[model samples]
Target: MPSRTLSAMDDHDPLTKAISPPPDETAAEKEARVKSELEAKRVSDAIDDDIDKQRIAEKRGPKPVRVLLLGQSESGKSTTLKNFQLMQDAKAFRKERSSWRALIQLNLVRSIHIILDAIARDYYPSSRPLMKDPNSSSTSPSVSPPSHAMPLPKETYLDPELLELRLRLDPLWKVQEQLARRLMIHESQWKEGLHGGREVVVNSAVAWKDVFTKKMANKRESSDSGRINWDDPTDPGRVLHECAEDMKRLWKHPLVQNLLEKQNLRLEEMAGFFLDEIDEITSEYYIPTNDHILKARLKTLGVSEHRVELNAGGGLGRDWRIYDVGGHRSLVTTWVPYFDNVDAIIFLAPISAFDQVLEEAPKVNRLEDSVMLWSSIVSNKLLERTDIILFLNKCDIMKTKLSSGIRLKDYVVSYGNRPNDFDSAASYLKKKFAGIMKEDSPLPRTFYCHLTTVTDTLSTQKVITSIKDMLMRDNLKHSTLLL
Candidate 1:
């Protein structure tokens, strides 16, 4: 007990003895130990989460592959889509139905409805024009339905005024939505989706083809029944009277007038929304930094069409944001930006158009001139290296004409002077592209041209597969080890 130094206490061992932990610890000590263990466990858990996130990022693989289809109006851009992307065969459609790609497309279709309806309003006046007379004949030409045939109308063609209205009002959204819904129905009803509890139903196996045929038959029957013999003018005034009433109602529709005021705005909104949805789909499915392939319609949006990533896909399948631009000359200007990042450009021209093109050759010179003219416009601006695929669309028609030696021009006045020979048409194309071909040995990796059609399913498959194979080759540079 004399002044004990710490060292001296060590020697005595009293301090150690007093503080020594017992074999059986107290509850307080146990609680502290448990707390320390829990803290360490939490740190470990956080590290695990971080590692998991990293693994997920790496596992998603590279960016998606994109394919762009660009061509003139009536170049069979839509037909190419029918042949390539659309699930034509039972197997492909079934496979795609369960895929995120199908979902993305469905979403695109759904968005179109909203956009088009907004546009339709613009064609009709916010308020109906005053009638010539309260008691005027209902048959007045102005009393016709809006651009589209009113659902209840018994006429085959919409009234001329209404048709003009549709032309004035952009109902592209509506038309697009209607088509999309039809496709959706085809998928759900003809393919897969739950009917009850079990997933045993094989929609493709059902007789959906017959259902369509029956519908056509019914339509024909109705058409025959509703036939109006214009030769007989016994009821001329009757048709006129009904139209006047419709015009009165249409003019009075507040909804129709409201739409007219907003039509231009609606189109702007549609284009914006379509682009946004495309981006959303792409961001969701496609990997970052990679481009997507587009086979877009050129009729409504034209070439200045924007693309957006719709979603991501697993290995082997890549997600895309695609726009089918209008094929008409008016919208071709818009196709420029789309060509920049485009990996491949499909020049769609109807096989049937070959003769007509040849007939006009004296004016345009070479088939290559026509193609080169288009190619030059888009190719000159491309930042990303690109390849081209020339689609001889409507090959079914071409093949039929080719095989039968029938001049399609006989039936189609637009074909110009009927060509006596197919060789002239073929020779015309070869000569036109000859200069460009000579400039690029064998074929330029920068471009590829093919004569194809979506209606001819086999040819379409070959064309798309070949284009995708080329794209995969490009991707191979970024993914050589994986391959």
Candidate 2:
């Protein structure tokens, strides 16, 4: 066996002199080196922890394709949201249906307020009235009465039932005034341009916390005889039910009907439309169905978000975040932030609104506003890749309007008295959108068009299903983790 080689001696040899053994570490130096190593390890571990946190956050958070619902006021955006909930979270929607009772109460009260204003207008003779009415009650007051309002204060014609309804629902009328006052106060708090600022002018007013409480109590009264406890959680529906018979009488009275006619008023044309269905809606344990919820019309303010878990085959799929922004011209400015990161935009254009003008600025036609708004959207560079769907909403209303002799030519002017039927008018409206899209859209977006009554479920469901499927196909190709 060969002898094992030993360390070379380096005291005198040149080759050995070139190499040296490591010097023995001093205690202080060793401590310093160890301290430096420990700090380096701590930094490394801290960096790893940060990376892990970021990874976990990315994993745990919802990976939803955000969709923004864009449209002008009364274009059925809220109704579309309800349809989505019905398809995805039926139980949740059912739960929310009961809450509409208070809103309908507020609505009934609002109609009374309008009638009161009309009465007050005809009650006295002057350009100025007893009170400067805060706002008109019509959801769409574009059409004036025959330009000849009938004479008023036919007190002999007013029914006792009318008087009773006007009295029983007085508390709710007071509630509306209180709500309107609260809304105006919060209205100033609204921030401009989509910073997630909210307007409490509509549905939110119903949700105001402790909203009905009196600010300064009256101690002098012996009893709260005139008071109505609307805050009593269980009895809102009961109150309307109790007054149902009287409500029907009030609505059916000849003089009352004449007044509505004279004012060209149709309560069904506005929101909170329960006057006709008091018995059915106010029955005990009443729960609204998907259609009832969607059919609900309120001049809703602010943005609402609904989250849904998509289904792929039989399993829960990706999360979907849908946003519905306020559609009024004043509220339109609040729609931009929602555009960020949005993958799809469902735009509702009331094609029949060609005859109607803006409630805010009566000079601008509603359909014209829709066209200009559509043009701005399609042409916007911020939404270059966002898929666009146009819903020509209120086909039911459009058809009714056409048959009632509201000529499209009278409003459109360019129509030149074309065929005055549903198909012709609808086709013309479709062409208007198509023409605008062709001329204004800078992107090669595939336009999905549908004629929707918004209240009709079967047809709207078909369109909703088609869009849902397409969205799944397009969005899932990129999200391969999805089943």
- Cα-based TM-score, every candidate: 0.38, 0.67
Q: For residues 1-483, could you state the per-residue lDDT of candidate 2 as single tens digits?
A: 999555566346656655533268688887887898799999999999999985786588756757788888778887887666656654544333324444445455445445544443444334222221244344421112210122335553434555555565445433544433422333333222111111224453344322322211132211222223334454555555565666566667777777767755655655345567766765655555555666665565677676766565312466667888874765765465456567678889887677666666778988999888888888777776667888999888788888988788888888877899999987887888888777777766666788897777667767877776776567423232333
TM-score of 1: 0.38
Candidate 1 lDDT, tens digit per residue, 201-261? 1232333223433443343322222222233332222222323333334433465446545
Enumerate residue pairs that collide in model 2: none
Q: Model 2: C-alpha RMSD to truth?
A: 18.5
Each prediction's whole-model lDDT (CA): 0.40, 0.60
RMSD of each: 21.6, 18.5
